[model samples]
Target: MSEQTFFATAPAGVELLLAAELVELGAATAQAARGGILFRGPLELGYRACLWSRTASRVLLPLAEFPAADAEALYAGIHDLPWENHLAPDGTLSIEFNGSGPGIDHSHYGAQRVKDAIVDRFRARCGERPSIDSRQPDLRIHAHWRNGQVTVSLDLSGDSLHRRGYREATVTAPLKETLAAALLLKAGWPAIAAAGGPLIDPLCGSGTLIIEAAWMAGDHAPGLLRSHWGFSGWLGHVPALWNRLLAEADERCAVGQSRIPPLFASDHDSKAVRATLINTGRAGVADRVRVERREWATVKPPPGPPGLLIANPPYGERMGETDDVSALYIQLGERLKSHFGGWRAALFTGAPELGKRMGLRAHKTNVFYNGPLECRLLQFRVEPEFFVDRDAADRHARAAALNRAISDGADGFINRLRKNLRHLGRWAEREGVSCYRIYDADLPEYAVAIDRYEQWLHVQEYAPPSSIDPARAQQRLEQVIAVLPAVLELPPDQVVLKVRQRQKGASQYQKQAEQGRFHEVHEGPARLLVNFTDYLDTGLFLDHRLTRQLLREQATGRRFLNLFGYTGTATVHAALGGATSTTTVDLSATYLDWARRNLELNGIHGSQHQLIRADCRQWLTRTLDRYDLIFLDPPTFSNSRQLTESFDIQRDQVELLRQTLRLLAPGGVLIFSTNHRKFRLEVAALADIHLEDWSRRTLPPDFARDPKIHRCWRITQS
Candidate 1:
C-alpha cells in the first residue's frame, strides 16, 4: 500500500488525545491540529484508526487539494475530481464544507457548490448523478477551504465515531462518547482497568463514560457497535481487508469481554439510569456493566478495589444552574473524602472553581472543550493525605473578617433593606411584579443596590469615592455577597455581583461575561429576559418598572417606538398594552437577540413587532416613520464606534429630543428618560416644544428610596 495522508477529527480539547491514539495505532507520524489530528501513514493505518481509535470523531482521507478562490472556482475544481472512482453514480452522498476565504463565507452555500460539482461531473460522464442523502448517506465528503486553497476529503469514519451505535436516548447535557473516552484515557483508566480493579461512574448521565471505559478495559474495538462506515459505500474499499480486521476485532472482543473488570454506573435520575442500561446493552456491555438509580450523596464504591471513579457531573454553566448546583459540588467533595477514600476520581466540570469548593486538591487537571464550554478534568487521588482543609479554613477566616468589618454598618443596612423589602414586596405582590429593587445604598458603607428578580438577586456595587479605601470597599462588597443570600433566603450563587462604575460612554454595553443565560421575569402583562451576570446592569431596568407600565397603559391602539431599547423590555410592555405596532432600536446585536427572545417568550412577534439593530441616534435622524407614542431612554454617555459620534445625554438631549419630536404624530406623547444622576432637562432649549416632568410620578415605589435613580419627562410637539 502507498503512503497516504489522513485527518482525524476530535473535540477541541481532545485533539492531542486523538493524535496520541493515532500514533499508538502505528501511524508513521501523528500531529495535533485544531479540533483534530493530522497524520501520514499507509492506507491500512487509516482503516485501523477508523475501526479502533476511541477519541477520533471522524477519519478523513484527502482526495484532492486545489485553489478555489471563488464559488465558481470551487465548483470547477471539485468537478474535475474523479468522483466515479470514489462512489457509484447511482449512490447517495452528502457534502460537508467548512471554512472560507475571500468569496466563500457561508458553509451551507459552500456545501451546495461542492455537491453541485460532484453531481454535475457524474451527470456529464455517465448521464446519471448520485442522489443526495443527508441522512445515512452512502458516502460522506468533507471540504475545508483556507487562504484560497481547498482540501476535499473522503470521510471514512461516517457520522462521527462518538455515535458508537449506542445511546438510544439521552438526558440534558449528555457527554459526547468521544469526550468520555478522552477523559478516561487522560485519567489513565486503561492501566487501572488492566489491573482488574472495579470502575464506577456515580453521576453517569446515559453511561457514555462507563461504556467507553468498559470497551477500553475489555479491549473491545469501539467501532464494533457502529452499523455504518463511510468506507462501506466507497468503491475503493478493500472489503477482504476490512472483513479480516472485523473478524480479528470480534475475536478480541470475545476475549476482552471475558477479562473485563466490574463496571458500576449510577445516577440520581431514573431516566438516565434506564438510558444507560439501554445504551450499554446496545454496546454489548450490559451484562458486564451494572447500573443503578442512586443519588450521588449515597453512591457507595463498588465491592472491589477502586479502578477509576470518573464522571461528567452537571457543570452549572448558567447563572440559575450555578446557584442550583453549588451545594452539589460541596456534597460531592464530602462524599469523596468520606466514602471513596482509596479511589482515583476524575471529575469533569465547566467551572473549575466549583472543584475548589469540593475541599479536595486535584493531583492533575487537563483542560478540555465540552461543546462550547471549556472544562477541566480534575484528577484526584481520594486519599487522606489529599484532603487538606487549610485552604477551606483560610477562606472561612477571610470571610469572617469581611463579615466583622461589614457588621459595623450591617445593622442599619439590613434594617433599611428589610423595611424596603417589606413595603415594596407587599406593593409588588399587589401589583403583580416579580422584579424590583430591595436596597439602594441605604447605608453609605454598603454602597450597593440589590434587586430581587423572582428568586434571583442582582447586586450592583456602586464604585466608591477615592477617599474610601479600596480594601475596605472590597471587604464591604464581599460582606454583602456573604450576607445577602441568607438575608434573601436564596442560595449564595443566586446572588450575581457586579461593579457599577460610572461608565463614560458605551463601555457599559461591553460584555463582562459570555454566559448567554437569560431569565424571564414579569412586569405587569409582559415577560422579559433579564440577564444578571453578563453586564453592569441587568437587561431589564428596575427603576423604569413604572415607566414601562405607563407606556403599556397608554399605548393601546397606538404606534409605539422604543429607542435605546436595551433587551426590548419596554417594547414588550408596549405591545402588551395593545400597541398596534412597535419598533425597537438598539446598537448591540446581543441585545437585539435578547429583545427578540423576550418578545417571542411573550408570544408577541411578527411584522407588528420589529427589532432594528442600529444606533438609535442615527436611526432617529433619518426616519420618516412616525409613532403615536415614543419612549427614548438614551445612555448617560455612549461612544460606541457604531455611532457617527459620541453621545452625552446632557450635551445632545436637545438635538435628540428635537429629532424625536419631528417623528411624533399629532397629539402623540414622546417620553424621554435618563439615568445620569445629575441630569437636568434643558427646559429653555426645548421651550417651543410641549414638555412636562413625569419624573416623580413614574418612579416605582422600590426606586423612590433612591431619588437619583433616574429622571423622566414627557414631551409633545403639539
Candidate 2:
C-alpha cells in the first residue's frame, strides 16, 4: 500500500479562490488547477481539506492513468488495475464516466465497460464482486476520458459536498450549499464579518448566506455536519485525527456578540422566516444568526457604522415568467438610497431590468454563469446622497454591460424567477403562438402572469416572512403595482389585476361591468363584459383568452360543450361563434349566475346556454349528450370534488383523452387541454386519434415564451 496524490473538485470560476483558501489552511504550496487546486500532501492534509476547505466540491484519489485507443483497450487498461486494494468484500462502489472522444461516444456504455472490467478483475481473483449503490456508494470510481486517454480515480467525496445535510427546510429559490459559500466569498463577507460588522442578507431565501456567515465568523467547519467523507473508508484512514480536528474547529468557535458583530437575515415572508429558522437550527447556527421578517420599507440599514447590506431581491423573471416586481426593485433602490446611507451593498441579480429599476448606477459588475443563464452581481456604494452622476458615457457603459450579462445565479430567490420568466416568455414569442401570459405582472408583484407552461421552470414563490407588517407591505405592494405602468409604458387595459374570486348572496347585486369603452369588448365573434378597474381584476382571465378564441372557431354549427366554464366566457364565445347550442358546467353558483349576466349584457340570451351546476367530470359521466365539438380543459391537479376525481394531466391524460374521444362525433374535434406546468403527452398511447399540438399557434403576443401554458391538442379520427 502506498500514499498517493489526489485532486479535490471546486466549482468553476472559484478554483483560484479555493486554492487561496487551501494555502491559507496550511497546505503545502497549493497550485490553482482546472476544477480545483492541485496539492501533494500526506493523509493529514486530505483530512484537513475535508474539515477546513469550504469551497472544495469533492476530493478524488487517482488510482491509475492509461492511454487507450478504443473500447477494448479501455477495458484492458481498467481490468488490469488492482480493484480490491480500495475495497473490501463488503464494499459497494459506483462509477461516473466522463467521455470526450468518439471511441466511447455514449457515456453509459463507457461506464458499463469500466464496470465490467472492474468486476471481472475482482471475480477472477476472489469469486465475488462489489455491489453498486448510485446513492451512497462507498467507493465512487470517477473516469475521465479525453482523446482516447482514460483516467480512473476513486471519488473521495462519497456524495456531493453540496449536501451539507444541514438545511432542514427550504423555500423557493434556495441556494446550493457550495454556491452559497462561493457567493459569500465573492461578496467579501468574511473579511467584513471578521473586522467587526454584522453579515446581513435582506432577502435571505433559505438562511444559506447567514448560516455561511455564522460558520465563517465562528470559525466552524462545514464538513462537520456530514458523517461520511470519501477519505474515511480509504487506506491509512485516521478516525482519531478527524475527530480531533472537528473538536478543535468546534473549540475555536465562539458566540458572536450581538453588539460587537452578528449575522442577520430578513425577508418579507412569514413562511420563509419559518424555513430560515428551521434551516439555521439544522445548521447548528440558530443561536448565532438572527432572522427577521421585514418589508424593505420597514427595514433599517445596518446599525453601527453601516456595514454590508447584501440583498438578492426578486428581479421578477428568473423563477417564473413574470417581471411585475420592477416597482418592488425600484422601491428597494429608493429605500436603500434614503435609509441605507453610508452603507456598501452588493446586489446579486440576473435581470438588467432590475438594475434599471433601482434607478442607481452600479459601481462594479461581475459576470458569472448560473447554469445556462449569464448572471451578474452588481456592486453599489451608497452614501448620504447616493450617486447622482452627471454623464451620458457612464450610463451608456452601464447599459452595455447590463445587456451583455442577462443571467444570474444569485442563490437568492428574486432573480431566479426573473430569469425563468424571461426565458419562458422569449420561447413562446419566438414560436408565434401566444394566447395570454400566465404571469402575475402587477408591477408591484414584479410579474406578468405565471402559466402552466412557465411553471415548467419550477419557479418558487417565497412564503411571506412572519415579521412583515402586513398593512404596510400590502399597501406598499399595491402602490408599487398601481404606479408601475407609468414607467413601463404598457396600456392599463393590457395590464389586468389577477385577483381571486369569491361567491356572494343574491341580494348583493355587486357592480361588475359599467358604461365605458372598456365595459363591452369583442373577441372576433364573442362579446365580453370587460372591467379594467376596481379590485385586483375583472372576470376575464387573459391567459385563457386564446383558448376561448379557439373554442369560438371550433363552435360553428356544433353542439358546443364547456367544462369548468368560469363565468361562461367560453360559452358566450361558442354561442356567438355560431354554435347551434352551448352547454356550460361548473360547481360555482355565483360564477354560473355571473356567466348568465355576461351573456345578457352582450344581448345573447341565457336560453342559448344550458347552464348546469355540478362537478364537471361527474356531470360528464352522468350526462348522455354526445357533442360534436367539446372543450375539455381540466386542472393540472385538483382535489376538489367539482373536477377532482384526482385529476393529474400527466398521469391521467390518456384516460381523460379516451373519455373525451368518446364524446366527439366522427370528423369532429375534442380539444383536450390541461394547465399542468410539467404535463408531457404520450403521443403513442393516444394513437387512436390524430393529435395536433396547437399550443404555440394559439398564444397571444404577451404570453409567448411558455407556449404550453396548457397544451391544446386537437384530436379527431382521420
List residue ranges in candidate 2 displaced over 4 A: 1-4, 100-103, 254-260, 315-323, 384-718
Alpha carbon deviation, residue 292, candidate 1 (Å): 1.3
Q: What is the TM-score of each candidate against the true structure?
A: 0.63, 0.59
Q: In candidate 1, what residue range of length 10 has the lowest lDDT sum?
A: 315-324
Which candidate's TM-score is highest? 1
lDDT digits (tens) for residues 32-88 of candidate 1 = 776688999887889999999998989999999998768889889999999999999
How high a TM-score does candidate 2 get? Answer: 0.59
Q: Could you give candidate 2's per-residue lDDT for residues 151-224 as a string of tens digits?
A: 89887767777778888888766766776677777777777777786667878878877787777767777777
How high is the CA lDDT of each candidate model?
0.85, 0.66
Pick the lDDT winner: 1
Q: Could you tally the backbone clashes for each prediction?
A: 1, 50
